[model samples]
Target chain A: MPFVSIRLAGTATKDQKSAIVADVTQSLVTRLGKNPAAVQIVIEEVSPENYGAGGQLLADRDAPKPQEDAHAESSQ
Target chain B: MPFVSIRLAGTATKDQKSAIVADVTQSLVTRLGKNPAAVQIVIEEVSPENYGAGGQLLADRDAPKPQEDAHAESSQ
Candidate 1:
């Protein structure tokens, strides 16, 4: 089985996480030709003080942006 | 939306990815309380030769094993 591990850094709204999981799973089913029943998705939430970027923790950065931009590329 | 990006190293069987996506998505909805529709999962497949481990490319590893072991832990 192609077990996909998604290490999401930064806190996300409950609804937001759900939306991500559902659509992402669908993408895998259609784009990769995987069965909808076997797909696995993992979402981890990290604190701004915990995740770092550009050499600084997100909490320390002037703009503590989450890594949501990676998926900002809408497949829609 | 929380965009979950899963970079899968090595080719995966169609059944495997499907199982992983489905189960994982359920876990997120149950554990993180995210909406199924809003969640977005992306699985990028990499050739075994394209992935690396312990400083050696998977294609060059003496064992040449895929990184699917990370999710070997079954939450089922």
Candidate 2:
């Protein structure tokens, strides 16, 4: 069974999660022979304000969104 | 965004899957204050052949053990 579960928002590097469980258990033990202790890799890490993208967060995705019609035509 | 990925062997009832999405999403929204749509629940179903536990396939999980001193001999 290919049990590769990697949920990420932060915190990787225990050699980048053992190189993603040794490159997905050596690609399922060299193209599906399997049985490297049945290959179970689970990594779940989170906390960039609980994670988001495009819709923002990750510290407001590098800030700078104050257009507001160029400050309302420079305060009229 | 709590994306709950469910990879199970064979198919589950469609209602079953949507239930998983709803349950986890609602749990996130209700408890953790998350956006419902941002909770991506990915379902990846596999065939019995590609899945194994206790060094055996799903087809084999239900069948009788030939006195191999069963570890978790029931979960169908």
Candidate 3:
């Protein structure tokens, strides 16, 4: 049996969660030959303030304008 | 940064959760030298019916009398 835990930065719609569960279950079944009924998936939505990466809180990182991706691509 | 996700079979009290967070944070800080401020811990309490081990649901397994542990010990 495999228990999968997914942590997201924010809340997800019911439909989105359902899709994720289905996709994760299918992947485990296909790759590991695990029983679909035995697969468990728990999705945890944490506030941005509680989630951090690279020593910066997600809330602070997201607060800035969404220009970093474009700036990086342009520089490349 | 270390993100710790704990999956429990059922709900935990706020105090219990706080203790767990503190313990986990301390462990990471001591062992990995991670910053306490950068550590994120999410506790996911899932229903027994959703968790399975050895192809049996935790709900069903827990429904039986808790004598199995004693029986195994006695046998040993």
Candidate 4:
């Protein structure tokens, strides 16, 4: 059984979820000759606060800065 | 570095999530001798409607049914 788990940075519409499941199933069927019905896919939407990169939480990294000048100074 | 993704059929409390992350990280460290700090675990709580098995959506399978007799009749 091919169990595919997909993690998205944010939420997705029901349509998007449906399309992903279908697309993934099709890929497995086409490439691996797997049974579409047997393919299980799970889509996970992660909150920015819970996911981190570059040693910074995404929520913090994407948050608005105080001022353009201050931000530029901090980056330097 | 190990990235672990866990998909649960339903939601979990924040405390439970924290424990799960810690437990998973510890497991990797103990078994594979990976650094606990380098272990990344994402816990996904999936809606029953979005998960399917045995050719039926979990939502439908877990939904409240009609009278007991009617349900028994349909299963046969």
Q: Calculate each model's fnat, 2 decimals.
A: 0.19, 0.00, 0.11, 0.07
> Across residues B1-76, which tens digit of lDDT does each residue of candidate 4 receive?
8999888887999999999898888889999999888888988788865664433445655877769978899899
1 or 3, which is superior by DockQ? 1
Please give the lDDT score at residue A68 for candidate 2: 100
Q: What lDDT score goes with residue B28 in model 2?
A: 45
Better of 1 and 4 by TM-score: 4
Local distance difference test scores for all models: 0.64, 0.63, 0.78, 0.78
Model 4 CA deviation exceeding 4 Å by range: A67-76, B1-45, B49-76
TM-score of 2: 0.50
Worst 10 residues of 1 chain A by lDDT: A1-10
- lDDT by residue (A1-76, candidate 2, tens digit) is 5465656565665765675556545644554455778667676878777677887777677556689977998999
Better of 1 and 2 by lDDT: 1
User: What are the runs in model 3 whose C-alpha is more than 4 Å off?
Assistant: A64-76, B1-43, B47-76
Q: What is the DockQ of candidate 1?
A: 0.12
lDDT of 3 at B44: 77
For model 2, the chain A TM-score is: 0.32
DockQ-sorted candidate list, best first: 4, 1, 3, 2
Q: Write candidate 4's Cα lDDT for A1-76 as tens digits.
A: 8887777787877666666676777778889898766877776688999989999999999988779878899899
lDDT of 1 by residue, B34-69 (tens): 576755667678776777666778668656355576
lDDT of 3 by residue, B1-76 (tens): 7888888988999999999999999999999899999999989787655544443445655777578887998999
